[model samples]
Target: MEERVILGTERDFEAFAAAFSRRLHAGDVVALSGPLGSGKTAFVRAVVRCLHGADQSYSPTFTFWHRYEGTPAIDHIDLFRIDDPRESAELGLEEALDGSSIVLVEWWRNAPELVAERRYEIEIEGSGNGPRVVSVRRVT
Candidate 1:
């Protein structure tokens, strides 16, 4: 398990994502825990951008999942509207937990069981001046 504290600005988040990208292996699962309007999607964008060397678009907040054919391939999932954990299984969410891709799950508390045994959790809290406080934790 590894962890770090990162800044809240877009650029700082991007830099943090880039640095984290270096340590990612194929079966990496990152669980993002934050309230609405947090920078989960923004941070994911930076990661996908770093992996592909090009810009990827927004999160599939409504559709629930977005796939990016980046250098390492990334699957971004937002479970905000999901009301039940079992619905995740019906939605094929388990497919996202593959060993060949990098998966980032936002609002991951919705379906905690979907997360891998070894995963990274990023918690974002409100800081003064409208910035964010990000805390990274990895399961042991």
Candidate 2:
């Protein structure tokens, strides 16, 4: 299923994430696509806060991957720094996607092959200080 939402405030986005998280489970992959400062990391943080009950997730743009402990683990990944898609092998992505945790990948376009077929794709469109148009789809 796919849904399009307009988020006028940061609180609205968090509310949407909280509702969306209820549909997620371990082994699920969420691909976040948006321009810089489009609230990709903020979305991840919201989802993590809802599921893991904490906001410890940071953009793994430098570290590539960060895992937060919870009932169903959260594997947050940022591939913006990857010059080669093959480098994802070193990030233990396979382990994260092995169905033990929920995986959120920002900049998944940098390494599309690393993403599983059955996954959720979220695209956020925004400019200036306007409201964001967020499109969420299940790409199974």
Candidate 3:
């Protein structure tokens, strides 16, 4: 099933993520896809905060991935710099998806195969300056 919502402000966006966090646990992969400046990172930050109580969120664009400590640790990954599927394999994404933690992936389109069967696929649309439309679907 799919659900959609309009986030009019930063707080609204964060609240939505925080609430959604309750449904997530270890082994869950959240595939986030959107254009640049579409608030994908912001949503990840909010979800991380909900999972661990600290923001400690950063765009993994440069490092490719970062693991944050928590009850169920979060592995934040950015696939924007990846150009090929081989690159993802080299990055050890398959190992990371081994049900060890909650993985949130930005620019997920670059490596859709990494996504697990039980996952949440979220797509955000809109410029950062205005309200954003977030579509959430549970993919099984």
Best by TM-score: 3
Who is ahead in TM-score, 2 or 3? 3
Whole-model lDDT, model 3: 0.84
Q: lDDT tens string, model 3, 1-140?
A: 99999999888988998999889989999999889999888888888888788747543534888777677878888899987866777786665688988999998878777778778999999985898899999988
Q: For residues 17-136, what per-residue lDDT tens digits would candidate 2 score against the true structure?
A: 888888999999999999998888888888898887764654343477888877788888889898798887777677677899999999999989999999999999885567888999
Which candidate number maximizes lDDT? 2
Pairs with backbone N, CA or C atoms under 3 Å apart (clashes), candidate 1: none
Pick the winner on TM-score between candidates 1 and 3: 3
What lDDT does each candidate get? 0.78, 0.86, 0.84
User: TM per model?
Assistant: 0.86, 0.90, 0.91
Candidate 2's displacement at residue 1, Å, is: 3.5
Total backbone collisions, model 3: 0
Ranking by TM-score: 3, 2, 1
lDDT of 3 at 28: 91
Clashes of each: 0, 0, 0
Q: List model 1 lDDT by residue over 1-140, tens digit each.
A: 44556575767767887877777777899998877777888778878878877756644634889877655668888889888998888777655676778999998889888888888888877644476777888785
Candidate 2 residues lying further than 4 Å off, grouped into runs, are 55-62
Evaluate model 1: give its TM-score: 0.86
- Using lDDT as the yardstick, the better of models 1 and 2 is 2
